[model samples]
Target: MEDFFKGRDTGLVIDWTQMPTYNTIMAVAAGAGLIFMYMLGRALVRDRDFRAEGWALTAGVLGFILTATGLHMTLEWPFATYFPFDNIVFGEPSLAFGVLLLAASLFLWKRGDKIVAAEDRAAEAAATARPLGIFVLGMGLALFGIALAGLVFQLFAAPAEEPISGIVADYPMIEAIFMSLLFAFVGLGAALFPIALRGFSSTRPLSGTAKLVGVVWLVTGIIFLLFGAMNFFTHIGLIVNTMQ
Candidate 1:
């Protein structure tokens, strides 16, 4: 029993059965967010004929699904017992790349020749407010770079632990770093959603669906902020608990 307890403490074993029902609820909520985004994307494409933005939104939705699923698995399953490395490849990178592509599409959509004249006028009018736009684009690029680097690191780096039945072990340091990066990117991406929503609201007269999308984006941004804060607090709590 002592050995089992020690293993749990050291992250050699994880017990998912102990998770509270609230955890499951949060997981479901996260999954719903992803699905909502996806459906919205499809609706936009079909109804509004906005193909580029629709694809971008679809990617963002998929990214959210991966992120939510990863979080759910991390909390609901054994961290060390299952294949942790798979989470990094499928969950982290997918979320990051998806968001990056989404952001890129948005950036281009806003600045492409089709809308360049309008965007330029908007830019000139809000020159000072435009810093946020630049920041969003920069953060999107950074996230893509980080995702690429993580993928490379996963490919060439030594396994953190021996594979069990073909499942690769999770490296604590790598997992921590990747999660941190992911959360950072998500937070920034969430911030951009509200900004884009506002832009859409101001410049173009959106139909009922677009209005709903803006509201959803705002709400999702708040949820992502909460999620990021929870992750940060959990990490801090872990460190403090370890010290004791």
Candidate 2:
């Protein structure tokens, strides 16, 4: 029992090569990236048809997955054997994003038909904005705080027990900075959403700030997708190195 506990503490209990869970999680993250890209693009193109139901369903499912994974990480600290701070760095943001996405999904699912069928969709959406909009804006603020924490703490020093850290063991600081920027992009987009939502409600075009937010999401999405894809290779290498 002591040996088992020690192995768990040292991150030696699990065989890294046999566990491809990180790759799977990264793939889900890539899908999430694609969803954000599509959502932001649609928002940018105000005249485009709203596929609310489809997107709502997709986002809800993904949001649920992220929420579950994040909640587990926070409560159980699965992979953060050596550095518990890793749990906060990865878990908190995931939880925030997941909750917001789930809320958005629910809003769309409940009001999708009304939104789609209305002659003035913006007005319909505007009428529907109450607690949900406020909730999202608050979450946006939380994400921003998380981003700031990541930067200030230099969480890139995360130990090898964290999979991504293992993958970039040589350039931890660079990876940390890049990841911090990505979170900042997402946080900025979320924080600016209410302004854009208000613009939509008033039937005004997307403001410069709103358009910039869309662009930020686009860039972040692309980077996440690429990073997730690249991890399939790099993560495997990490595991193999661990085995040796």
Evaluate all candidate structures by whole-model CA lDDT and list the values in order.
Answer: 0.42, 0.63
Residue 87's lDDT in candidate 2: 69
Q: What is the lDDT of candidate 2?
A: 0.63
Q: How close is candidate 2 to the true structure, as a TM-score?
A: 0.75
Candidate 1: residue 223 lDDT (0-100): 57
Number of backbone collisions per candidate, in order? 0, 0
Q: Which regions of candidate 2 fall more than 4 Å away from where they truly are?
A: 1-49, 126-130, 157-171, 201-203
**Tens-digit per-residue lDDT, 2-87, candidate 2:** 43223544353435433224434644563464456446345425656677887688778878876877777777776554456656
Q: Specify the highest-lDDT model's number.
A: 2
Give each model a TM-score: 0.32, 0.75
As a whole number from 0 to 100, the lDDT of residue 227 in candidate 2 is: 71
